[model samples]
Target: MDFDVDDAATLMALLDEKRPRRVTQSLLSGWDMLQTDLPSRERIESATAVLVGTGLATVDEDWGMLLTAEGARIRRAVPGRGLGMRQIPGILGAQLRARGVARADLTLPAALYDAAYSAYMEAAAHREERAYRRHWWETWKPRRQR
Candidate 1:
């Protein structure tokens, strides 16, 4: 019944699976700019492991990360339900019953989940802090202000 926000956030990210759009990335330079910033490699790996363990996602060495069918359905339904992240267990437990799955088969450890969220945020902040655009106009824009 009790759940941490950090844990829920991490679980949400696990549920929100993604894969590279190689064609789009190849065709458009701006694709990188529009993409969600990647979490640290360590964070991503750890999360991927957890996702795979939980049967929420699968990673293909060639294709990157993807949601399992169940994961995708849960992602679409649960995230937009307007429930607080802390209600993750409640919803997930409901899902188990609906799917005729054994609750004992799933592990929802708070410490493990919390670590993923914290690691991702830390990495993103470290990566973005003091960063600036590389375009020619970007170089001049700061000088123009001074």
Candidate 2:
């Protein structure tokens, strides 16, 4: 499957949120960081299929699309694993201080950190881009001008 960064991010976020087990609907609902636009049911299903096919995620008769062992490993390797939302900014600040570079300046070796970082950044950027677009449309742009 030719899944893009955003798709991988969505899968990973879903796996993180609904760890251990999750059905399709639950995965969709729990994807707060990545599903603001809310893809059609067809798209969600297709993405799930791709994730499973790639072995980044797994599905059972009961659990729709839970993380595989590989997936868990990837999650744990993320720069700020086990941190809650409230702690992310602080953790990122600490990382930046320790590294002597901006968080955005850091890049992981492709062999080691590529998959997890790719997925995380994809989801994060997707949300940021969506929010920017929404603000531009709803607040920045004048409706009368349009």
Candidate 3:
């Protein structure tokens, strides 16, 4: 969802309510708060573009793209915040299963620890690769000038 600063701010405000909100209502409320003309369908579409670009929201096949985990975390960390705790264990369990974290293996405490450690190491390696790429770009550009 692409949104500008105004729209982003509005979404953040509504998220503070910690209640499930419809996309349409949220858009309307945002416009109301801004004291601007009501948003047309086209305007809403444009705002969605901004929101998605900024990584503030995402869409899922099951649940139309709402705020992402990072967006939720930001909402929670805000002062005087009241973010909802959506259980979503099904989502986490599904991700684990997709990553081959067997449910039966979890029953064995020792195996569960080992599986988790392996997954953590895999993620750390990917992160390190990204960091290396970023560092290389930052360093190589300057050296090439000489």
Candidate 4:
């Protein structure tokens, strides 16, 4: 599933160090806390829908919404978009700048870890790698078995 900037922003709001959160309570507040530029409520809701459809988020009536294990894993793996030496300072500056004026996409944060990540994922899909890992886990012993 393709995740656009809106989807990214929505996911950011939902993620609270792996804690469950009420959607209505967390959505706008997270953006404000992070000094993110305001996106329309509809936009945020739409993004949430996409995330749910992709199995990245689960909504519980009692506990609100939470990121699934896969969601959190993907989030952790997501690399910043433009985290170059010169860009680092600018990204920081933007975060501390005025909220609405701040461009949410600045520093191009997290367009998903595509380059090396894609290659790694592709390689991991091979059965040979899985077999090797399984064999190492099942057969390898640090000391001689008695």
Candidate 5:
């Protein structure tokens, strides 16, 4: 399938909107907090790389992933855009909350991890489906008892 240019553009626009805000939210977590959050893993990864490459976000020993000062400044300057948190899947939410670290300040690391992991899972499922469609013998073979 062709990549969705519109989806990518939407993400860019959202980031641009946040570029001048004085928000305390990390960009990744902020993006996740959007009601119009990115629709696919590809878009999430691509947008993330773009933000990191542009110095809007950086990997930090303290923060894991964080919006740069400039990024936060830009976000502040932009007119306030309301951000809404995406509802985590029930089981995933429970697991994360159970870990005793479910604070708003910690949302970025959780969001980044969730995005990458979800992308990996989706890609793996796609690969397995393709292999099944192609009639890969291993896909059809009965599993050996452990």
Candidate 6:
């Protein structure tokens, strides 16, 4: 399915927050960062679907998801409304890395970028575990012989 503008906007805002980026966490954290109420999970899920479908992000069974190069470019290009400087520079670094760049100057500090990315990876791992447990029985159900 194509990305609805509102969905894309919400995802962009979440990623813009000054913390590790995750579909749900970004939505929850956005409330504090933007001083607005949190968005519903449906909305976040819809946005995530678009991001994944459009190759703007990647979903990991062990990691939540992170913005892809195309996603980062879109986020940088379209700054969120009323949210000044809502682009994550590390995503830019990611964009470069995706293109096989050895080194490049980034708008964000290396230390801050490293911290946020690391935090995101950790969060993704936890999310993956929870998801696995949530559906473990269904996945491990004994298969009937054909």
**Which ranges in model 5 have alpha carbons more than 4 Å from their true place?**
1-38, 60-64, 81-146
Steric overlap count per candidate:
0, 0, 13, 0, 14, 0
lDDT of 2 by residue, 1-146 (tens): 23333444455555642545443334444544345544444444555555565556665544445766865665555566566543433432333234331111122133322343345557768879999998788886677966
Tens digit per residue, CA lDDT, model 6, 1-146: 22233444455545632243643443455533443444444445555555566566665543355777766666666444654633443333344334432211112233433454455557768989999996886677778621
User: Cα lDDT for residue 51, model 6?
Assistant: 54
TM-score of 6: 0.43
TM-score of each: 0.37, 0.44, 0.38, 0.42, 0.33, 0.43
Between which residue pairs do clashes occur in model 2? none
Q: lDDT (CA) for every model shown?
A: 0.44, 0.49, 0.44, 0.45, 0.41, 0.49
Model 1 stretches with alpha carbons more than 4 Å out = 1-38, 79-146
Clashes of 6: 0
Tell me the lDDT of candidate 5.
0.41
List candidate 2 segments past 4 Å from native.
1-5, 16-20, 24-26, 81-146
Off by over 4 Å in 6: 1-4, 16-20, 23-26, 79-146
As a whole number from 0 to 100, the lDDT of residue 44 in candidate 5 is 48
Model 6 whole-model lDDT (C-alpha atoms): 0.49
For residues 63-144, write the lDDT of model 5, one tens digit per residue.
Answer: 3444567544544443334532232222222332333221121223445446555665576579789988877665666788
Write one digit per residue (lDDT tens) for candidate 4, span 96-146.
232221122112112222332344435546757889898887777656661
In angstroms, what RMSD does candidate 6 have relative to the true structure? Answer: 16.1
Candidate number of the best TM-score: 2
Give the range of the ten consecutive residues with the poorest summed lDDT in model 2. Answer: 100-109
Ranking under TM-score, best-scoring first? 2, 6, 4, 3, 1, 5
Q: Note the residue pairs that clash in candidate 4.
A: none
Which of candidates 3 and 6 reaches a greater lDDT? 6
